[model samples]
Target: MKKLTMALIALPILAIGTTTIAGMKYASDDDRCERGERYSQEDRQKRNPDKMVERLAKKLELSQTQKNEVKQLFINKQQQRETMREQMQSLHKTLRGLDPSAADYASALAQAKQKAAFMAESKIDERMHMKAAMQKILSPEQMAQFEAMQSKRKHHQGMER
Candidate 1:
């Protein structure tokens, strides 16, 4: 009778512990793409890219070929972003050397701005490419759903600020 009573008492504790651990894992995974703590390329490669492909495939009902193409597109975009970030870092270093108020500083600043603009353009192109790739994979309804989700996310972000 004592063993039975102890087992019943321990059961709820074990269930609650399991629930807490599972909830923490889910929260961490869901917030991987959040700003400020955005996942690095290595982390994305390890956890996100494949998971995204899988989830998107399930959500969009993608075929195997489409999934493959979308995955490649994502990988390419990730690489391009890494390259753009490196270019931005290099340009920042150049900007740091020039005196902000000097006559020559205008030309230096212009050059830096040009480089920054190019980087931004590159990222825009990458986004377009990824969207195009996704379009090939997702049905019209699924595409609309994805767009709605993106819009909602942006709105929520704006609200948070």
Candidate 2:
């Protein structure tokens, strides 16, 4: 009877502890970068593609095919994002290497501005493509759930800001 009583008491405490831990948000890579800190290994692993797909599959009750499709989609998105990131880095390098005293400074600056705008547009294009592809891939119910999840995430992110 004493053991039973202790177990009952411990159960609720354990539940509370787990709930609190689950509710806490950790810093993302972008947040760490903006704060001039490095992303910890744990955070990097959290963003791994397989981990993300597994989480989504569990949340949405995805079938094997859906899981594979979503995983591929994520891979494609990451590749496209990396390409854009490389371009942005190159643009920054170009601007940084330019001599302010040089006559071509203004022209280089103008070219950089154009590239920046193009990158911004490319981002929008990627977003639209992803949305369209997801709509085609996810069923109505899953799409609704996915959109709701996205909305909640955006809301939480906005509150952080």
Index of the highest-TM-score prediction? 2
TM-score, prediction 2? 0.70
lDDT string, candidate 1, 1-161, tens digits: 99999999999999999999877764764566545675566664674567778987886787898788878877777677677778887988998888977888888888888988888887788778778877877788989988887778889889534
TM-score of 1: 0.64
Lowest-sum lDDT 10-residue window in model 1: 26-35
**Relative to the true structure, how large is the alpha-carbon lDDT of every model?**
0.79, 0.84
Q: Write the per-residue lDDT of candidate 2 for residues 66-156, one digit (tens) a residue.
A: 8899899998887787688789889889888988899989998899899899999989999999999888889999999999898899898
Candidate 2 global CA lDDT score? 0.84
Q: What is the C-alpha RMSD of each candidate to the true structure, in Å?
A: 10.4, 12.2
